[model samples]
Target: MWRRVTSLSHLLSSPKSSPQLTPTSYGPKIWETLSTEVSKKSGGGIFSKERSPFITFVLGGPGSGKGTQCSRIVETYGFTHLSAGDLLRKEITMNSENGAMILDTIAKGKIVPSEVTIKLIRKAIESAENDKFLIDGFPRTEENRIAYERIIGAEPNIVLFFDCPEEVMVKRVLSRNEGRVDDNIDTVKERLKAFRSLNLPVINHYSNKGVLYKIDGTGTEDEIFERVRAVFDAWK
Candidate 1:
């Protein structure tokens, strides 16, 4: 799936998973899209700088147990978890035009607009009350990464990829019972296809940068979380 995001296909594919969802590799290419442009408002005081904390980009497809692992990370560590899906879903709930499109696209496993997705991520970053953040379910495209570097101005400390098979992910989503509109098998299939499409390139971006960490995604929630914790432990 991570492969699809970065080596991403234009069209949707089958279901899959990658740590909380690390199945693929990421490298420097994702950052290649960065432009030299910077906005003064978001540039945030280049003269008198505070310490820049490392960011952890937690990436995965839907039902990849990212949320579960994020909870564990928050409990043990103090990093904030910013879920892109949750943010988009919130927009859908509010009945925004973009939100409506996102819901439709996600249900069909299609990629959302990079600009819209990045805008949501930027919002989360600006509103962050803490220095450390675990950005989840974002940058599913090279474009996503570029937008972040362009708009957000910070690179990730590490990129965590959850490695799980498509079959496993499909089963998990079907049984998830979260009452999400995108959780049913039909929509899940589309979501999975979209996930496969966007994830490869994203993963490749992180892997090439040597920041990608792959972890087995099969098992109970605790088991999966333990793998995630292990990454943080080594990093910390």
Candidate 2:
């Protein structure tokens, strides 16, 4: 198992001392109340000292090959792969209660509520038997980052940010033909805008925390995975 090196000081600190999260007009009181109830029922968090998992938050803009790299990591390192996007999409497919909300949010290239996304993620992690996990395309905003930390009661062991150029990412997405609703030019542009405005801060936050590994996201799939392999291998 990978060792946890991040200090508990921040994880255990009072909310006031934590980094100030971006304010949103979403119903914060309702979310916090629900999150607290869920956390309490889940034994203070999805993880405990005895069952803490090795988590790697895989971050990148759309078509940055984060999903591709996550698959390779899971195959090579025995870590379970969980894509937040995939989970939300699954909810849409199942026509769950949040299906309409998630679909509309995704279609507009807006983020789903942290409360909803975090619940799905927590459920996925709890159901998996693996002690190592690669959570791809997550913590897309500072709100996401904070909500996760508050509800999960732990920090990722490491974070991987795939740095790819926007032009390259757009070309790759357009040609990949994934049939995703947000793969077209307009949505891709919106997603990129969202990435810059929201995701970059989360990336910088991890970098500041000293647990982020940035990998070159150019070139062939094999080439990119090679760079990713070096990071995971070192962790091993």
Candidate 3:
């Protein structure tokens, strides 16, 4: 995991202070507690316009290799890749009260509550020093999209959809061997179904907004990333 050293906690500790991008090892539970305490003390939300980051939301099915390509993009383009799934998994490891629920949700291939997932992403954004971000596996539902916009008060500058076939995605997931809770065949099917029923609309929303760049996610990682590179290059 790429991490930046920041002093955001010190800033948030003060009731009237605005958040300054700072890295902290505090878990999501601590961050949420701090945020709620701060909100009550300050009588306002934690977000501010000064914290607006140039975000790219990466959308894809169960096994579209978004994670793999995101690493390459981070290396090549200097963007922070914040994987929502990874964040949730970390919460489980931290023995959070929501851990069992998140584990069950992932095993069933259902989306975690939007608020829970967004809080993790929000903390990541606040702590990172980089302005460019690739937010992976987020906004999996319409509610997720709405909650993120309402809470974060910003939209993604670009949305990258890895358009891959269902069969291809299944194969990739089966072969992934990543020890993820949702990597089994049954879970993959459920995830694909969720992607179609829930995630597709989010993609379409971005498509209509004209910030969506659909990449043919069928070839080698390098080949697919070439197409991805072209899209980001044009954006630059």
The candidate that wins on lDDT is: 2
Error (Å) of candidate 3 at residue 75 is: 0.6
- Model 2 spans with C-alpha error above 4 angstroms: 4-44
Q: Which prediction has the highest TM-score against the true structure?
A: 2
Question: lDDT of model 1 at residue 138?
Answer: 79
lDDT of 2 at 123: 96
Estimate the TM-score of every prediction. 0.76, 0.83, 0.79
lDDT of 3 by residue, 1-236 (tens): 22222312221123222222323454536534533443443343334323335678999998888999999999998999999999999999998989999988888888899999999998887788886899999989989999988887666767877878899999999997988888999989999998989997797787677566677788799988887776665444
Q: What TM-score would you give candidate 2 relative to the actual structure?
A: 0.83
**What are the runs in model 3 whose C-alpha is more than 4 Å off?**
1-49
Candidate 2 root-mean-square deviation in Å: 10.6
RMSD (CA, angstroms), candidate 3: 13.1
> On lDDT, who's better, 1 or 3?
3
Regarding TM-score, does 2 or 3 come out ahead?
Answer: 2
Cα-based lDDT for every prediction: 0.68, 0.79, 0.76
Q: Over the full model, what C-alpha lDDT does candidate 3 score relative to the true structure?
A: 0.76
Q: Model 2 residue 228 lDDT?
A: 76
In the range 177-223, model 2's lDDT, one tens digit per residue, is 98999889999999999998999789878877867777778888898
